[model samples]
Target: MNPYQAPLKDMQFLLENVFDANTTWQNMPAMAEMVDMDTAVAILDEASKISRDLIQPINRNGDEQEVRHEGSKVITPDGFKEAYQQFSDGGWVGLCGEPDFGGMGMPKMLGVLVDEMNYSACNSFTLYSSLTAGAALCINAHATEELKEKYLPNLYSGQWSGAMDMTEPQAGSDLRNIRTKAEPQEDGSYLISGSKIFITGGDHDLTENVIHLVLAKLPNSNGISLFLVPKISVNDDGTLGEPNGVSVGSIEHKMGLKASATCVMNYDNAQGYLVGRVDRGLVCMFTMMNYERLAIGIQGLGSAQGAYQMAADYAKERVQGVAAGGSPTGAAADPIIVHGDVRRMLLTIKSITDAGRALSVFTGKQLDLAKHGEGDVQTKAAKYVGLLTPVSKAFLTDRGLDATIMAQQVFGGHGYIRETGIEQFVRDTRIAQIYEGTNGIQAIDFLGRKVTGDNLATLSQFVAEITAELNELQHVSAEDKSAISTRFDNLLSIASHINDNKLTQPALINASAVDFLDAFGYILYGYYSLLLADKAVGHDDANFTEQKSYVAKFYMEKVLPKADFHLAQVSRGDSAIMDMPAELF
Candidate 1:
């Protein structure tokens, strides 16, 4: 089987033709100066080569070699340091960082494409740099200029890496329950004492130091405070000092992503500088959290694409018995690609993968518009970002996990073995749903913060947008029209019902939170598919347009109908869910 290939043609088609990302960037003042279609496409081509040649070579070896913890320092897999050196020398860690801090300052719309390529190359290897980019975002948004001056340049340039320290023993989803403590120092810094677990890239030899963004509570604060804690102390002149009382207790042995150093980090009087106000740490951290959520969602998509490539290649070569209804007198067996069941699996992966890519880019577009567009356009875009963020995160990762599993199954017993590497995709994709906030928490945030809080205003507006587009379709068949139109209606109506009864039906709403997110997720995918089909209907490449139409039809038939299953669960209320007693187990 050939190695995973970047879907460059499809990516270009979506960016230039379907999404018109070029136009979006052309109007944005920040990007208009530095980027255009030509520049962006060149960058994508370079990134694709990096993925295929440099990064992917280490993926399997990284998994097999994992990381070794020799006392205080963690040693990454062989070639990781060199690979990261290239990643750094290429200036990719800061692909979308602040330009003022020596970054390229690319738009997230384009950054998402780069991120997807890296994740496809090696999700674990990408984690080291991806976390740095995320932490730099938070510091850039909230840190004092002096702190930013000290850290941002190095973090962005790959001289230093970054980590987020929020997960403590007692605090997983609920940040308010965290026990990490921060005591004020006379020199305008804080001494942090905390034990954080599952810290990715918490410490490594890939860079000089790991700058940690830790969340801690002060002596008199009602809310948590954000702190910038470095593993090694940085002197006033921007030089390295001694270890700042931070050390790794141990790294967890996990099911997958073994190359990523998931550590139990102990900060004992670790010198940490405050970021933003003492009582607004969570607010500050959300800047980083939101960025990472979208990045992690892309991780799911990339991993799935990798698995699909492997399975598709395997099915063509590993011919066994003759396919059903094929010529019975054939001297050789037909490839499994000719079989219906295998085609169903392949189509399911392809349809969702395409739709997921569109969703990621669409959300990134909203983020850009929110940042740069004026007046009502900005407001609408920001609200759409909030409304769709959770759905994109949960749905993409949930489907990603499912897609990887299904792709592995296409290999039959070979999938279970390690040599084929399909099983590694399954193992790696599973963590995407768990980290970056579990998909369940994403749903709760969606139902509570985005949906119920807005009283369905944004949700209804989005549904209306979908319905209006459906109304404008030129030659949609009656069946597809009914399917698409009814889903749009169902989306708005169910949202309205939830809003109308959320107070009286809090229990029901809580129980149905995840289902509601899944239901809305299906609608969002359907809407994206519609947009793609509409744009491609009359394209010059008839074959490409025809393929787009077929994918949309497959989504409508095989995927969009899933909205019913989840929505029905939501409509059942809390009868079957909440009825169970506390001691039933």
Candidate 2:
């Protein structure tokens, strides 16, 4: 297996040229005091090392060893404990956490890139830390000041880890079906009782304690609420006390991410604190859920990147039948990369992954503006964040899986065998499309709520912004610019068609949801690819700049056409899909 090298050059280019993180940071009052381009570069450099040297080395071994379930305790695989210690000790867990609680307080734009590096190294190993960071965000946002003071510091510092316990045997994407119960107690706490399944980082030895953000309903109330439950009790002085009622029923043996503990957690009268107001737990959970959705998308992106590196390197070295144009090296057989089919697959992965990275950074910038900017800048940014969040999750993971499968094809028979490690990428990435709210659900949310629910107002605003930016670019060719503009217009037309007819044809949005999201994704990728190329003009590194232009052109010519096909499907409406009765199957 080829070593996973963080795509640092492309990352730096996107930050400095495409998105201009320096200008963004300088403008935001909250971030200007904390980061500059040089500081961000240094941080990324260290993250790359930690990912390459520490976490990645244990990836294969961790998968083979898997997490052990002995009695009620779950034990992580070998080297996981050590690697997590170093990762936490360096404040990597709190890289983008609150500054008041001993966090580094970096921008999400920079954090998303760093996350890609760590996830690319090892998915299983990174889950423990990722969950912790997410839980801290939820607590910081909605928890009481006392709760924040006590839990935020440790959760951010990585001394303790966090888990999101939302799913049960009955409830997955639908949180309304949750059966967990929270009863009020005299000490201003609630006693939580429930069994939650598929809890990632639910129980692990990597941290001294596990803090769970659980969803449960109060007695006699149908409305759900959020609670903070810890594995071990904490005394007034903040020292560890006796074991709480929280216990791991068992660990799930999964298809991939084997080293990460996915436990079936059972809570029996566990003492818990409410996070946010009553009957509003779902709102609070969204704070963390939205963040996790994007992170999972990056998980898919990182896996595709790792698979591409291995496949591309293999194609160059693995000798196969002679190329149609003859071997460049003049040998009995040429490397597989000399074949046109292999070149197509590799280029497809490259073009999609590059644009996907740009999209992630763009979405991250919106999240930063929403959090730190004031007035209309903040309001508009929040709207964009809501609109882009689902797209970022669904589209990126959907493409991520496609890219991995294509990269595996480059390896041929070697890909199927476990030793080559390309198979792992496929298996690991499959979950990203399934978990964090399945891609199908994400599509519905995008089209049904985010787009049609607003009567296409938000979608129009986003499209107009992209169009304005594309019109301003001077380096891109007029033909390429026209292609992008045409698609933008086509997209709005389809959105309008759906919006106008959705009232009469109730199933229009639901049936057309996936196709609409897919078309939107391809169009957005096209826009970002051209934007990247436009930004790369007159760079000091001629080779890098030229490659960006070439990839952008290829994506425009080959991949952008995918939008038309999906749009055609959307035009078909729900007839073919909904006409078939469920009982027929």
Candidate 3:
């Protein structure tokens, strides 16, 4: 089979038509000169070519070869080193990073474009760079001038790589329980002694050094503090020194993403420099994690797109059945794509994937607006970024897993095999739902922190904004418009239900958080689908518009119904769950 093709047509549609990203950037002073429509197009085109031609070929090879941990070092599959060198040399690692630190300083909207392609082309290969970029972003945010000067350039240049050392055996997600220790030294540096599990790219052969952003507590600290520990120490003159008491215990033999190194990292009194203020480690760690959360969502979307392409291609060529009415002419069997059920599966994946693309890009645009937009625009952008982060992270990955499974079904028995690659997509994509934050936790964060804590201010305003956009739109079918309107109202009603009953009903929010998240996500995807359809109803690109219109209909008719079911669950409240006795079973 041919390598996955980047969906440039749909990407361009979202960038240029639906989002009007060019004008969005033109409004922002920071991006006007550097990233016009012309520049954005060229960048995407170049990035897509590299992803398809250079990176995709290694995906299958890496999966089969996996990563090997020998003695002190870990080894990646053959050609990974060369592929990474090509990536770093192209300056793609810093595509959206700081310019002062040797980065390109492009917009995050563009990062969504380039990253989606990279993940689709080869997710295992992409994880290495993804971790590196996440590490650089945290260090840039929390590190002092001296540390930033010392490390950011090398990270951006890809001469060095990076990792995050969190998730100790005892303190999975509960930071309050961490036992890792950081003892102070006279010179201000500390000796960090701890073990961190599930450290992605914790040790690799792709770079000269691995900079680990570790989380540990000081002797008398109230909470965890972050530290920067390098695998290979650095001298005052910026030269490489001896090992920093770090070692790889073992690499995981996993169900998927076998190509990416997931190491058991042991830091034995390793020398580490503090990143942020004392006991503010959660703040520093979250800065990197928030960035990673969105990237993880994009991973889901990418894997879905990859799986869809494979299944669609396979369905077209594999002939297995006669048409519903009769055999066409004298042909023995018709291609599976002719069947309505197969079409349903294909469209289910396509509709969700397309809407997912729009959702991801829209969230990225909010980040750009938050940074570069002035006054209220910036405030509103920041609000959406915070509100939608968990939704985007959870919704995309959950649907990504669903999409891959659906794609696998399209292949029937063939999908279960290892060599067909569809199963690999299923396996590789599984990690997204579990990592960054579990989908269940994301929902709790969405409802508890974002909704009830703020009293649904952003969610309310977003509902109003989309309702107004729907009012102004033309040429959309009334049925489609009504479906969107009714579902959104149902969403608000659910919110109101929680608000009204919660004072008398204390456990309502926690009990209903997951359903609320699912309901909100379904509504949000429906929102984006409507926007896409509004633009596509009568566009210059006939075929493209037709495809968008079709997907838009499918989403509203078929997918949005799921929203109602989740809302029904929300309406049921904690009564059913709470009524069950602990000893009943």
Candidate 2 at residue 77, lDDT?
Answer: 89
**TM-score: which is higher, 1 or 2?**
2
TM-score of each: 0.97, 0.99, 0.97
The residue pairs that clash in candidate 2, if any, are none
Stretches > 4 Å off in candidate 1: 538-540
Candidate No. with top TM-score: 2
Task: Tell me how candidate 1 scores on lDDT.
Answer: 0.88
Clashing pairs in 1: none
Write model 2 residue lDDT over 1-585, tens digit each, in one string: 767799988999999988899999999999999999999999989999999999989998988899999987799989999999999999999999999999999999999999999888899988889899999999999999999999989998999999999999999988899999999999899999989999999999999999999999999999999999999998877999998899999999999999999999999999999999999999999999888999998998888788889899999999999999777778999999989899989989999999999999999999999999989999999999899999999999999999989988999999898888888878878888998899999999999889988999999999998989998998988888889889879889988999999999999888999999999999999999999888888888999889899889889988999999999999888999999999997
lDDT of candidate 3? 0.88
Model 3 reaches what TM-score against the true structure? 0.97
**How accurate locally, in lDDT, is each candidate?**
0.88, 0.92, 0.88
